[model samples]
Target: MTTTSVNQDKPLPGKPGVAPTFRWAILTLSLSMLLPALSTSIVNVALPSMAEGFSASFQQVQWIVLAYLLAISILIVGVGRLGDIAGRRRLLLAGIAVFTAATFLSGVAPTLWLLIAARAAQGLGAASMMALSMAFVAETVPPSRIGRAMGLLGTMSAVGTALGPSLGGVLIAGFGWRAIFFVTAPLGLLTFVLARRYLPADGPTQKVGRLGFDYVGMLLLALTLGAYLLAVTLEHGVFGTLSLALLLAAVVGLGLFVLVERRATSPLVRLANFRVPVLSAGLAMSAVVSTVMMTTLVVGPFHLSRALGVQTALIGLVMSAGPVVAALTGVPAGRMVDRLGAQRVVFVGLIGMVVGSISMSLVPVSFGIAGYVTSLVVITASYALFQTANNTTVMTGIRADQRGVISGMLNLSRNLGLLTGASVMGAVFAFASGATDITTAASADVATGTRWAFAVAAALITVALGVAVGSRNRSSSDRHD
Candidate 1:
């Protein structure tokens, strides 16, 4: 390559200084991360408004959210691999442009199905952004400061999740539902410009031993995940005949995926790489931790209103506390991972989760919002620590060429956890409450259900703790042997 081309492809200076170009590049990456998260969250508050606008039922309007999530879930791993083969910087810019245009379409679409289609297109763009943005961190930041970079991305994600509802409410109330989409469109455009101008150019694709992409594996896995998500999320988390059939298809698709991956010349995923202790453990614990985190979101609002008699209007305020804590703690947690090492920090984070979970299980309704919020703060803060530590450990531990796919896998695991928690945790809460219709259940019963559900959450985290410790010990033994 020419010297100019080489210079163009090189990432920022490895010193991790406060250079203007480097800062701008980070901002570009941050916006890429923020946009998808913002899309995921900002739309929820607008769902009712959208239903009214389209003259659609609530069930139909919900497809707006599901379609977006479904596309992203199915596309993430595939796009990540495509980025690896084609070029990260090139594909990311394309993703940004697509996302921006899709945002515009979402704002102006006259039909509900067209709006849903736009959201799915947005998801395709989001999958690229979500997968490759993390891969870029390793390229852009100094090796020593990667933890901080990961933490910043995590913070941006939390902020997006936290900021969405309030922002959407204001926009909808003032300018209508379309305004919510319109507001983010310009931000998306700015991200596209910054990325194209400031982010590093794509280097030549690295040729691994494998010469072709495994298209079949990608298809099968996408099908598997799509089916599983639909099964778990549909019908208000109720597992019925359709859910059963979907779950069956998911399992069968997974089996076929493994078989196809094992046979592929250039596998979409190298199945053997999973034997790497750190990577496997990290992904597993990420899913488990995410599941536990989702429990707070699923259970908290109900517990607040039903058990503590908090007004319906104020429930959102209480729910925001955990995400706020997560946003605040994300950067600091990343710094801690840098100084203390990921292994130690992982344990500390999980231990905090365990304590917080136990607290949630025991806090009496008599103690009110103060008690619930305090426990929640602990869980979320700990989650921030765990996420930062876990992500840094997983991403930095992998090979450069594999970073894109692994990042996808990592994010996919978290998504799966959230999906599982939304259904399974909700089920546990219902089962604990002993109510077929939780909305109509007695307050004391709801409180009892809260206790039991969190106790289950605590158990799940303990299992994750075991995974962390076991992985560490296994790594040590492997080295010694």
Candidate 2:
């Protein structure tokens, strides 16, 4: 290995500075975090409008959201690894540039397919952003204040998500749906400018001899997830046969990926980390929580419009409550985790989710929009608590060297869970209603399916509760040792 001089003109990693430029650098990185988080849910409220504009089916329109998520899901780990090998600042800047360009392309897309392609491009940029932002934070902040910094970052993410739908709806109503994409472009450009001016260049520059990128593992992982998600969307006949084949291919591909990772000199995901109980449990809870949260996002708007006859604009307003609660509660949850413990906070949050899910399930047709909104608020608040605690726990337990991989896997698990939730929940809704479109006679049937979905969500949260309890018990024993 060859050694290179560390840049003395730049701020040292983990050093505190009172300079205004350093503060601005942190703000730029934080905003970069905020944009992609916001983008995830912003398009969701506009799905119906997009469908009508393109003369597409509900399933086809869903690709606009799914494609971005799928792209991010597969690419985040690879991007994170690259950031480690290259430079975090370089990746962050490049990501911002690409994301800004993709946003413009999405705005100008004339067809649904083009829009989906643009979204996938946007996701590639997002992967770069998401992978590097956390690494930047860990690098910039002192160890003593890392928790506080992470809490603020988590809060910013929650606020961004909370604002997304409402902001999208307002833009769509005032100007046009395309403005939603356009709004992000300027923000991305500004984030890039700030990052370049303020962030120090501090990433790996020395070439580690014979270090290999896990190209095969990346390819197989993408195929596996893409195929499995496709299978969930298929209805019947030859399409079903193809879906089954894809599912099988995905399973085989995943098996190959594991073997490749095991043999690789530098693996994308370090399998050995699973031996740590905190890492394993925290990651598992993260997956389940992500699945539940995303399913609600997917189902909530449709439920509002089709079942309750709420206006599209108003639906965003109602949906905003959950993320708002999440944002508001995030800092407090972080503080609680720091003061009490991650396990106790997580256990309480999961229990809250169980209650919230049950409340949502009990909502009746006679209760109307007020009732629906109330139930949604509870569910959203519970989710916020769970997410804040889970994220803090996962990031806090890992070593600095492992943070990139852990963050990448943490995000991957969340997205995979979301993809699974959307497909399975959509399939369940279709089965219960016996129709793709929910209207008139199908309204009651749709509600039945939604209630069942909530019930299943409740059960999943209950399982999380058990896991949380067991984790707390283990932590106590470890402390005694």
Candidate 3:
């Protein structure tokens, strides 16, 4: 396989390589990243109010998030393939439009089902943008600056993640739960308009050739993910009858997807890409990184509020520390990755995570907030280093044309990790607490649960570190290295 780098020197806008308007392109992509990132965490604050307003159960309220995640997981690859066929810019514009519309619908939705459906639509739009934004970053930036550009993506996401809960709380308190969705509609619209005005056209330099898409592969892929996520998210444990059936469906669908791809003229995914050690290693480590990250994100709030007896506002502030540190560290971390290489940066990150997770696990009730905050900062900083560097590695690992699919696969890994974290951590928490209903658990019980969860997260991070070390010697042979 052959590959070419975009020119380092600036070129005319709308032409290939680094365009003069590339800064605005980055701004556009940042907004795209922010919107989706904010959407993921923001709505949780409004779930209770939404349940009250709609007269729905807590389980039904969860579907608001579940629906969005499921849609993204299911459709990301197909939309990504569509981008490679139709054009990244075109798909991006369409996605912004769809997301904006869905946001509007969500704000005005009268019924729970309608709201869930709209969230699903929002997820579809988010998937398109998520898959294409990194590809656009790669196409529009020089190879030397790619790490910095990727850092900006991480920065925007960190900012969004940091602000989401506070913003959601404000909206829910001042207006209603509807305002959570309504408030972001303008960002989506602005992104769409700016993209239309400033984003470069898909010129001949990166023009994709064939239009044929593998429908069978796409269907099988969707079935596999949809079933798997459904199984994971459902009330049943992994061994339960319904979960077992769905897992079985996922297995069969995956097998069929592989078989279909072997025969398809224009396959949705390049099956051979999996053989690349760097990409595979990066993806695997990424899943572990996300799982450990989400464990803290999921369990920390309850631990703060219940175990540490922190106030609601203060809990938000303490939680915000993680993303704040992440935002500040991202750019510098990117520069380090560029200078020393992703393997080295990733090792530093894994070490931080291991230490941070261990520290958090050992935090006794007697420990002050300062200790907790320090641990959070270290853990978030680790992700800042790992995420930006690993993303740079994986995106650059593939041929330029394959970025769309690879990005989708990357996001899929992230979502899967998050789902795993939510389920596994919740189960662990319940077990440690000695009750399924942790909401009313004693402070000591909550503390025990939180410690156990962090311990498990630490173990997971250690495993990921081992994998990264094993792959370190193989990095040089990987195509993009």
Which wins on lDDT, candidate 2 or candidate 3? 3
For model 2, the stretches where C-alpha displacement exceeds 4 angstroms are 1-22, 45-62, 109-114, 173-175, 233-239, 302-313, 363-367, 429-437, 442-444, 473-481
As for model 1, its CA RMSD to the true structure in angstroms is 4.3
**Residue-pair clashes, model 3:** 0
The deviation in Å at residue 184 for candidate 3 is 1.4
Q: List the lowest-lDDT window of 10 residues for candidate 2.
A: 1-10
Q: Write down the worst ten-residue block by lDDT for model 3.
A: 1-10
Per-residue accuracy of model 2 over 1-481 as CA lDDT, tens digit each: 0001112234644324523244565577678779888898789878988999999999999889888877888788878777776667777788889989999999999999999999999999998887777777666655444444555667778878878877988998998889999998999999998887777665445453456766777777777777776665554212367777877888898888888888977787777877666778887888787777766776687678777778876876777777787777766665666667665777778888888888788789679888877877777767766676676677774665566667777778877777667667656555665655555535677678778778888888888787777777787788899
Question: Which residue pairs collide, candidate 2?
Answer: none
Candidate 1 per-residue C-alpha lDDT over 369-477 given as tens digits, one digit per residue, 9 for 90 to 100: 9999999999999999999999999998688778899999999999889889989999999989998788888999999899999999999999999999999999999
Distance from true location, Cα of 63 in model 3, Å: 1.6
> Compared to the true structure, candidate 1 yields what TM-score?
0.95
TM for every model, in the order presented, reads 0.95, 0.86, 0.92
